[model samples]
Target: MDSAVITDTKTSMKAIFSDFKQLTKVGLSLSVVFSSVAGYLLAIDVINYFTLFLLALGGFFMVGASNAFNQIIEKDTDAIMKRTQNRPLPTSRMSVKIALTIAILFTVSGIAILYSINPKTALFGAISIFLYTSVYTPLKSVTPLAVFVGAIPGAIPFMLGWVAATNQFGIEAGFLFMIQFFWQFPHFWAIGWLQYEEYKKAGFNMLPMNTKDKGAVKQIIFYTVIMILVSIVPVLKLSGAFYIHPITAIIVALLGIYMLYFGVKLHRSEENKDARKLMLSSILYITLVPIIYVVDKFLH
Candidate 1:
């Protein structure tokens, strides 16, 4: 009986972790880590191992707090959508009270660690949580423009990590923020298009309610063009620690154009699968383009 009880306790612990994963949205949190690391790396003259570790740990909690609060706010809508129906809060596997407590605790702890780094880093982190939870979370159901609002907080981790490293915000950090900010349009629109049906069922107005693909596709291509233009801005000048040769910038520009071509083609095709493909391409481009920037910075 004692052995059986031990096994049951361990099983329960595993189950609890699964529920916490749902609350934290682990994949999204890790994406936050990637951007934060990229920013931290770009801003620093030499990487400090301890500082990097602290940034990662604090960033994880900040992201987790945002995600947890998002889950709490959307628990009702989550239950309505097939994609989110089984989440911890929606499925009643965890109480709303418990989720709120976790969210607050994570947010506070994250902000405190960031404060230890610098005032600006902590301020930005607190703002991100506020915007994500108080503004973006509810705006999802009310307007399609929520994507714009969401992108502000979403793109912040990159610059937040930079500020933590450099202790100052300037053109260099602004450029980094712009890259993530502009990338969000194509990335999120593709997601909005791909998940329109599910989102509609949940009363989330992600895509335009009109079902018109032309305007949406146009926006994607436009942003892709803008992204390519802005992405190369740092290459034109000796801006900061970041340095990219014109040739590398051209290569990155071509990649952006390659992505833009798909966005335009998807618009013309008007196929759901093609739209999904564009979304995946957007994901790949955003993830890789930063790596290219870091590599170019090192090589040039």
Candidate 2:
């Protein structure tokens, strides 16, 4: 190719990669990936390095694809919201056609890699992507219940990795899914409370639309309490597989209390700043729990 042609090709490649990055919501998606990998490691009896790597890779792309489709479907609403207005789709950095094409390609590739590991994993991944993009994305503007709908698919990755490793769904996978499912309420509600105005502007009714009088905050505290209790379920069982020793149980309990402290403070304060703080605390709790899970597994 001529020099100008080569330069143009390189520029095009760069633009495409940048758009793809936005599609993936790379940072957020990768964090989901970390928890999935942690789940796989914690659940697996025998560690196959290659299988683990593929599981993470497949899980990451599946989540990335889900996010891409979500962005595409919400592009119009996203343009109206300040938080999402600059995203590739909203900014016209990429066309919806291109975004959809990438979404389909990535979703297929992700599911294929997962299928190589196990059929059940591939099936669950397909369902996650479908529920997130098709169901949750469109529901955002329609009702506050979108948060609950979104959580179902959001919680899949952690359990997904477990299914990939064990090729079965049982109590272990159920616990992983439940912890993440319950955690989402406090995590996203705090975010919803903090960004209620922005979300309102975009026609989204987050934070229990009508009741401003501590309903959302009370719900956050309620869920946080449940999350704390769920975190310790494995400790009572003596099977070294999921059981935590007394010391590790204390560590997990303290972590839960720390999160609970923030949840209660936000409940009482009901201030936007406190809501944001609680949101950050929720993120910290979720991210750290996987580490706690892995550590306690080894410690015991």
Candidate 3:
């Protein structure tokens, strides 16, 4: 082969790989995988490394597939939004045919791997993709309730991990789902608050009232309160597999208080900086709550 041809081929491959990264929205997909892993760890009595690996792989592919489909569906709208204008689809770095092919492959392989774990896990994985791509993607422009609808699929991965570990849907899985479901409100609202103009450019109404009015800020406070309340529920001995130690409870309460402080600040000031702080605080709160729960479980 000619040296020039080889160099051109290498460059093409690198470009394709970079586009693939954008198509997958790797950071967001990985975060979803992390939540799934946390749920698995919280549920498993015996740590199975192989099962954990499968769960992470399946979860990543599932989320990646959903995001790829979202980008493909929103390619035109994405091109108009500053934040998403450079995505592979929007930038023409990748073709719709190729992106769709990749999404289908990811969906098939992801569900198959989850099925290897259990059918229920696979079922929920497929449902998450369907709801995200078919329902949430289109609904963004239709109603602010899209956030509520989208929250269903967004909240699935955490509980999906527990379902994979125990192969059952019960109060424990429900509790995990509820915590994430409620958490989405404040988290996404702060994002919607910060990126209001960008989202408007894309015709997305993600905020509760479709505006960053006092009503929307009030809802953020309401949901944050509910999220904090729900976060400590596992510590209350209401269910069999979901109780935290007293010390862990106190620790989680402190974390919730810290997050709630930001939520309240956003409510009081209605400033973008406060909303940004609440957004970051929400991330920390979600990340820590799972770790503390799993640690408390192991210790007790």
Candidate 4:
């Protein structure tokens, strides 16, 4: 082949890969996978490497598929938002036909992988995608209550791993789900606060009260407190089969307190800087708390 043609082909391939990454939202999907892996580590007495690998793969693909459909549904709104305007669908970097094909493949493959683990895990995976794409995606522009609905699918991966491990839903799984469920409030509100203008441009009512006011900030602080309270419940022996060691519980409490500090700061200052700090601290709290729980479980 001609040298020019070869160079052009390579460039095209690179662009395609980059668009694929945007379509999949790799960073967010990987965080979901990490949570799923942590849940698996917590549930199983003896870790099965292959099963963990499958859980990660299935979780990533399922999340990617849900995100792809969301982008497809909201392509126009995404084009209006500064944060998402450059996404593949919004920018015409990828065609709807191609994006749909990718999403279908991801959905099918993800379900199949999870089904290999157990049918219930696959069922939850499908349910998450449906709820996210069909319900949460469309509801974003309709009402702020969408955040409450969106939390269901958002909190699934952690518990999905437990289902994959034990093939049952019980108090332990419920505890995992509730922790993430409460955590999303503060985490998402902080983002809603920081990106209030951009989200407003897209007509998304993500923040409580649909405005960055004292009421919204107060809700953030309230949810942050609730999240901290829930994080310590396992240590108090309130949650069945979900106990954390005393030392680990203290560490988790300190992490939660750090997140609470940012939430309180955001409330008092009403500044985007504080909101952004709360957002970062929320991420750290969720990530570290899970790891600490797994480590503490293993050691005890």
Q: Least accurate stretch of 10 residues (summed lDDT) in model 4?
A: 240-249
Instruction: Enumerate residue pairs that collide in model 4.
Output: none
Ten-residue segment with the worst summed lDDT in candidate 3?
Answer: 231-240
**TM-score per model over all chains:** 0.95, 0.93, 0.96, 0.98
Candidate 1, residues 1-300, lDDT tens digits: the string is 699999999999999998998799888888888888888888777889888888888888999999999999999999998889999998999999999999999999999988888889889899999999999999998898898899899889888878999999888888888888998888888888888889988888776442547888888888888888888887878567666788888888888887887888888997778788788877888788778877776765
Predicted structure 3, TM vs. truth: 0.96
Q: Give the residue spans of candidate 4 off by over 4 A.
A: none
The C-alpha RMSD of each candidate to the native structure, in angstroms, is 1.5, 2.3, 1.4, 1.0
Residues 22-90, model 3: lDDT tens digits: 899888999899999999998988989998999999999999999999999999999998888988998
Error of 4 at 283 (Å): 0.9
Which regions of candidate 3 deviate over 4 angstroms?
Answer: 1-8
Candidate 4 has an lDDT of: 0.93
lDDT of each: 0.86, 0.84, 0.91, 0.93
lDDT of 1 at 239: 60
After superposition, the stretches of candidate 1 with alpha carbons farther than 4 Å from their true spots are 208-212, 238-241
Q: In lDDT terms, how accurate is model 1?
A: 0.86
For this target, which candidate reaches the highest TM-score against the unseen true structure?
A: 4
Stronger candidate by lDDT (3 vs 4): 4
* Tens digits of per-residue lDDT for model 4, 2-36: 99999999999999998999998999999999999
- lDDT computed for candidate 3: 0.91
lDDT of 1 at 294: 73
